[model samples]
Target: MDAGQIVEPPRILARRSGDGWVLYMDGVEPSYVRRLDGAIERGRVLMEAGKVPGVEHGAVLKIDLGDELNQRVKTSTQATADAHKAQVAAAAELRRTAAALNEHGLTGRDIAHVLGVSPQRVSQLLNDQHARG
Candidate 1:
């Protein structure tokens, strides 16, 4: 995230960085969302499903540029989440491929070599797969 880049606001709570004024939204996933329609949709769905205890429609305190959370913090959180999600997915796929190679009579070392990863990484991948179950 670069300086001056606008980010998607939090769905729950926010405080204006410039004025220190707090803004809140009421609902309960789209709970506290910036989008009124999203909140209403979630509430309606929950109510229809009898999942929510109660529902509120289209309530908002204020919706600013979403300067509530520190920009750096928001950037870091989003970046970390994105990186971890990608890593989890990629690691799972790599392990699946590695297992397939192993089933084809490839040694762990052989799989590692073909996959351009460390032999230890092959073990890690296998361990991760076992852990998943």
Candidate 2:
């Protein structure tokens, strides 16, 4: 395959057959996804070899795996958002704790040692807390 050549994406037909999803591609046998791993593996091999043009890498030929895969994507996205929120909340809590410890006569170096952070970080947190107020 030429590196600069543009390959048109292939049209794929996906359907729920009985108990599993099946993907149909031109010039390729219909593959039973979630049933026979070989079909999925074969699709991957064909795409990698460029025998199947226009198929994106790592894509299951754009076959819709129905609700299960859709839900998984949603759940994964939510998890990522939750992780960010948790990190932000933890940073806010740390800043408040640093300020409280400083008010109790703990120096920036003492707070840094107890909090397992650099003295510079301790100073920054304290300054950030003051600015927020």
- Global lDDT of each candidate: 0.61, 0.78
In model 2, the worst 10-residue window by lDDT is 56-65
Q: Candidate 1, residues 1-133: lDDT per residue as tens digits?
A: 5767655432334444443433343433323334433543544554435433323332223334545546767788899999999998888899899888987999999999999999999999888777876
lDDT of 2 at 90: 98
Clashes of 1: 3
Output the lDDT of residue 54, model 2. Answer: 60
In candidate 1, the residue pairs with backbone N, CA or C atoms under 3 Å apart (3 or more residues apart, or in different chains) clash, namely 11-32, 15-68, 28-31
Flag regions of model 2 displaced more than 4 Å: 1-65
Model 1 RMSD in Å is 13.1
> In model 1, how large is the Cα lDDT of residue 72?
65
Model 1 spans with C-alpha error above 4 angstroms: 1-76, 131-133
lDDT (0-100) at residue 14 of candidate 1? 41
Candidate 2 clashes: the total is 0
The CA root-mean-square deviation of candidate 2, after full C-alpha superposition on the true structure, stands at: 7.3
**What digit string (tens of lDDT, one per residue) describes model 2 on residues 9-107?**
665556668877677777677766665445556566555565675666444445465789878978998999999999999999999999999999999
CA RMSD per model (angstroms): 13.1, 7.3
